[model samples]
Target: GTQSLHTNGMDEALALPTEKAVEIALRTQQIIANESGVADTVDPLGGSYYIESLTDAIEQQASEYLAKIDKLGGALHAVEQGFIQREIQDAAYKTQRAIERNEQIVVGVNQYQTDESIKPELLRVDEQVRIDQMAALQNLRAERDNDMVQAILGRIEQAAHIPNAPLMPLFVEAVEAYATLGEICDTLRGVFGEYVPESWV
Candidate 1:
């Protein structure tokens, strides 16, 4: 199930996959199998000089990247310092710029421009669905034993504060007690403060 989306710089709200796009995508797979005969070969470009060189270069670069991250005190430290986030942002920006400059041709996006409006059937979630969910949660909380729920939540909070604590069992117990996601999160939030991202701009 491949759906083509018109995402303007990772914004998912603008995703509109048309029926024609879906048909084209399906036809592409058929063409690859029938016309291109891609399925007939095992590692079709395996021995090609260009493919081999590109593969080696990619592997070497990845290894170097991992080594640099290890020097910076591993993945957690890199994430905390926003190094990983910045790298991803930079890569996305470069790709977008390349597409805009026509250096990268993304078929329907950068090349083969279409003037016709493609209004696909969009999925819409009903407001009543959320209201019903909230009502169900309220009912569940009201019916469950508050004292037991609080005791389990308190244990969960205590476990979270301890370094390398086995919190999985406690989480399982909390869920079995019919504790809502918000309740579990809120309990943990009290112990561990919510994450606030550092200014990257």
Candidate 2:
């Protein structure tokens, strides 16, 4: 769930600088693929003293945290109690303060400032593209088997009422039936309801 949320947010951010964003992402992935050395052999960094020590320390720290979480009844319990969010917020504040104080040297932000004269061309999402996507949705509905799609969707709605029913299969069927993403999400919203966050103090 967190990964999906992360991907969605990052996708929007990447779209802000579409071309350069994609290029940077691709290059980072390429460097990790080439230099990670996981494929060459088993236990690649097996004997490195610093790495081994660091691994042990991390494992111990994680185990301690997990034990504390379990004592309080696990990750869900920690979140419900606001401990996880508070801890994260504290860490983030510390990091932000450090960066502001120049204790953290973030290369582009702090260390290497540049004022170039030439302006770069930016990507823009055309209003026509949105209209075209809407038209595609309408075309799909016009061509697909409406009766079969309705039956499938009715079954999906019924399945949501039953406990422990994995919705993945139903989702795949919907996708295969050329169901619009918005339609599927609307059905889910009907079942689970929308999230309405409380105003922060």
Candidate 3:
């Protein structure tokens, strides 16, 4: 069963969605949920030949990719060795080449020639948002048990080094103790180090 949904705005590639874009995205989900009769039944298109074939094809491709990752010792190992980064880089490069060569038609970006440039309106967060958040964080640190935070953080660091150690509980404890994301990530960074991708460009 579906639990949650996120509908991306049309202008998401350019910038954060403007208010109008957000409204449209939300309305799309709302219409699907409220107006569309498809939501009345489960797997409405499941019996269709084309849909079943497409789903099977998607599953097959996904399984192949998962098998490749398993051979590379799972996701974390592959990422550490830069396999994922290189794959992403290769895919992006291929897409860009296609777009540039007219093999891919990207409307205004590639195929259409416009006499004037048109920029979409983008959503802008207020500068005070960061200031307010920092103030809240400072207040949280001033109030919560820092000793507990440090002790739990130490446990987290230790657990991270162990092979296949469960860490979600420690993370929950850290968050409950008001440990900032930066502090927790810094501990992991000290253990796993950062993944700096080799530029293919």
- All candidates: CA RMSD in angstroms? 5.1, 4.9, 3.2
lDDT of candidates 1 onward, in order: 0.82, 0.76, 0.91
* Candidate 2 residue lDDT tens string, 13-83: 43566666567677766665578765466567779999889989999999998999999898988877777
Candidate 1's error at 9, in angstroms?
A: 17
lDDT pick, better of 1 and 2: 1
How do the residues 1-201 of candidate 1 rate in per-residue lDDT, one tens digit apiece?
113323222223555445555566667667876898666776677689998898899999999999999999999999898998899889999999999999999988989989989765554567899999989988998999888899999999999999999988988999999887788999889988898878664
Q: What ranking of all candidate models by lDDT puts the best one first?
A: 3, 1, 2
- Evaluated against the true structure, the overall lDDT of model 3 is 0.91
Worst 10 residues of 3 by lDDT: 192-201
| Model 2 score (lDDT) | 0.76
Clashing pairs in 2: none
lDDT, residue 163, model 2? 92
For model 1, give the RMSD to the true fold: 5.1
Kindly provide the TM-score of model 1 when superposed on the true structure, using C-alpha atoms. 0.76
Question: Candidate 1 at residue 99, lDDT?
Answer: 99
